[model samples]
Target chain A: MTIITILDLLGTFVFAISGSLVARNREFDIFGALVVAFATALGGGTIRDLLIGVAPVGWMLDAKYLVAVIAGVGVAAFFSTILLKLRKTLFLFDTIGIGIFTLIGIQKALAQGLSPGVALMMGIVSAVFGGVVRDILCNEVPLIFRKEIYATACLAGGTIYLVGIHLGVNNTVAMVACMLLIIGIRLISVMKKIALPKI
Target chain B: MTIITILDLLGTFVFAISGSLVARNREFDIFGALVVAFATALGGGTIRDLLIGVAPVGWMLDAKYLVAVIAGVGVAAFFSTILLKLRKTLFLFDTIGIGIFTLIGIQKALAQGLSPGVALMMGIVSAVFGGVVRDILCNEVPLIFRKEIYATACLAGGTIYLVGIHLGVNNTVAMVACMLLIIGIRLISVMKKIALPKI
Candidate 1:
């Protein structure tokens, strides 16, 4: 598998785990937990594909992604204490996941002939929408909609990706650089307790 | 426009009004109100179309739906008291809206070669997903997942639609009957304060 694909699967797994954790916290049933996990892992890509007219969606075409998500649910269900104790590790994985998701979303949108501006928006949407959907399902205001710089990081990275490409950077280099940028912004913002001004 | 087209727009308007009312109750700003209104009105149809691989979405293809949603937002913003007093009227419109949404969703799914069972699911998703999304955005457990028999009504109506078609009923007759069945079920369930047992 390509490095990007591996990263995508890892990201999906982390997101799914996060979703299952939230569902368990809410005391949802096993079915609800699985639903939340699946939605968290696949919702953003599904939204992106649908918006761009891709049929059947990505996970629908590959069983590996489903396996990863199911594994995530299993981890959350059976290893709650261990998982919760690894807050720093989990946060690192989550940041990397969003970074990869944003880059892939931009690439897909651009491949579909969308303008750069629209592609950037799609990238941010792909990076953040799964968490948005998960929080909404768990009856909480979405973190991105609150005083978080979460989506802002994705937006900034997407812009940088476009700029790097325009500046004659290799596609692979631009993607990697953009991913690192997103990861850095997210990590720094969380560590520094930085947030957008509340409306 | 066809009768279905007109009903679809009406459904969008009523759903938008409901969303805007919820946003107003939450004291969201005007922009928030408008965003909520649009999501509520188009969310269900958008989900259905995306699942079926319809590109650009129905609203993106037609301006009338957007106009209807905007009108609904206007009513919510400028006539809150008047609208609140018309609870019965609003309920009636909402019931009809779901009815039409269900039938149209079933038709679309069937046209795309989905099985009867999947088509039924699509129908219910189309009927209720807008409210699901609206409630989620407003940070509430969705009514359908709570005690309401809302989705049950849609499922029942969709089954009837498929059965009627199998029994050699006219297409239009089956559709109209399905719509009435949904409307009647929803209205009766509400009037009798009926609820599904809590999980």
Candidate 2:
């Protein structure tokens, strides 16, 4: 299996777990937990595909993503306490996932002939919009919009990736650099409680 | 012009007006209100088209929807008090709008070869998801989920429409009957304080 596919599945799994955790905290039933998990795992990509006018969406084209989400929900259902206790580790995974998601989104949009600026926007959307949908379904202002400097990290990473590609950088090198930058920004921002200034 | 085309534009206009009114109440700036209005006006159809894998979405193909939303926002900006005073009339338009939206959604989904049941769900989605998007953007629980018997009206109408078609009814007859049923249900439900049973 390709590295991107593996990372995508892993990201989806972690997202689903996080969503199911939230639903469980709210005392939702198993079905509700599954729905939330599915949305969190696939919502961003689905929205991205919709925006780019892609048919069947990414998950619909691959059963692995759904399997990952179901597995995540199952894990969350059985080991809520364990998962919660591993918050820091899970957070680390989530940060890395966003970086990968940004890369995937940018690549997809660029392949669809979108300009770099719009592709960067799509990258941010792909990285953070699942959480936006999750928070909206949970009836809250999205964390990325309201508090975190989350999408900013993706924007930064995506821009650099685009620039690197323009400068004739190796594809893998550019992608990895972008991912590292996002991961570093997310990690540091969380540790330092850094946030964007209010308008 | 076809009646459906006229009604569709009218529905989009009213939806945008309602969205901008909410944004105005929240004291959002002009740009924010316009964003909300656009989302409220075209969000449902965009989402429906996306799910059915239609490229460029609905409004992207037709400039009329965009014009309707812009006009709605402009009216909201200039005559807030006048529009607010006409709440009952606006609410009437909103009811009719949902009916038309449901019909549009179901028809689109059916054209895409989705099952009748799934098409009915899409119809309800089309009727109400714009408000859901609007409320989410404003950081509130969607009113349809929290308080209103709103989606139920669409459900009833969509179900009847599907059944009518199944019984070999004329297309326009089934559509008009569906819309009238939705309008009746929404108006009566508001007057009688009807609600779905709590889950």
Candidate 3:
């Protein structure tokens, strides 16, 4: 019912769809696609929880996320062409999802008494590492490492959020600002094909 | 120094060495090699600990494992040809390492009061997932999933270990038996090119 919960489930669904689509593109079978979809949807949060000592993980406590992921996979499976046509819209939603995930990750890590630097790192990890993981399993260099401004966008947003909180900004206000910054960065950078300069 | 601790460190060393060597073979730069080596040495245990809710993970609390991994990378860098000549010896030690890792993973999960089935999976994850992660990061299908009976060996050993406990077998005896069986299975399977059948 809460907006955060809604965004979290929506993110899970969008992530799973992207994962399933990638698996299909690689000529994977249904089972492999499911595995990839699940990993992409939940792997980041699982890593964050493990690092912060959260037992059972977030998804384990909520069946909604699981249901959303499965639904995403099902939609990807049954509506590949239709989904492909909606790529731009899905990607916008995906960007929003990552922003929310970053916020959630930072909040959870901070709640666990982790230092701000680590909380920021976990935010980026939760935002992008699922796709990082998905790429790895599919036998490619992780996109975040080799290309794109993906994780950096998370870092920037997280930094703003942390700094705002440090400056006594309202929690809800800081969160909204963080999400907006990440979305703007993701969209603008992708449209411009901006990437970190290669070493 | 208990034998278990010693074996654990040695396993970490060997895994790191293998990881470093693989990185070098791929023409990766030193930074990439180091990343691969560290992941190979500790990634499995990290995954296991996270799943079982061990906060901060195993290597975070100890410096020795990091030292071992660094040493392995250094050795691999300077003695690539020499290490290649010792491949058979390294393989033998690696087999032993995997066996010990399996035991440790199972014990840790069981200590956390997880079900035996989950514990068995954790054992395999601990024994081989470091390599799984290494391979994935390096843009290869995880070797265990594709080309070997490696994880099956862990499952076999872990199953025996669990059943032995169920049958009221002595703890130390079961541990040793599990290690020996894993080693035996690994060595024999590799020598005979045994693998699980493709689906």
Task: Candidate 3: give the clashing pairs.
Answer: none
Candidate 3 docking classification: incorrect
Cα deviation of B183, candidate 2, in Å: 1.4
For model 3, what is the C-alpha lDDT against the true structure?
0.87
Docking class of 1: incorrect
Candidate 2 per-residue lDDT over residues B1-199, each given as its tens digit: 7998998899999999999988999999999999999999889888787787886788998888899999999998899889868999989988989999999999998887776766876787788889878987998756665455688888899998999999999989999899999999989988998866432
| CA shift of A108, model 2, Å | 11
What's each prediction's clash count?
0, 0, 0
Task: Name the runs in model 1 displaced over 4 angstroms.
Answer: A1-53, A58-132, A140-199
**Model 2 CA deviation exceeding 4 Å by range:** A1-38, A41-45, A48-53, A58-132, A141-199
Interface C-alpha root-mean-square deviation of candidate 2:
5.0
lDDT of 3 at A177: 94
- Decide which is better by TM-score, 1 or 3: 3
Indicate the TM-score of model 1.
0.61
lDDT of each: 0.84, 0.86, 0.87
- Error (Å) of candidate 3 at residue A177 is 23
Better of 1 and 2 by DockQ: 1
lDDT of 2 by residue, A35-102 (tens): 56877888898889888877657675456787899899889888877886899999988888899999
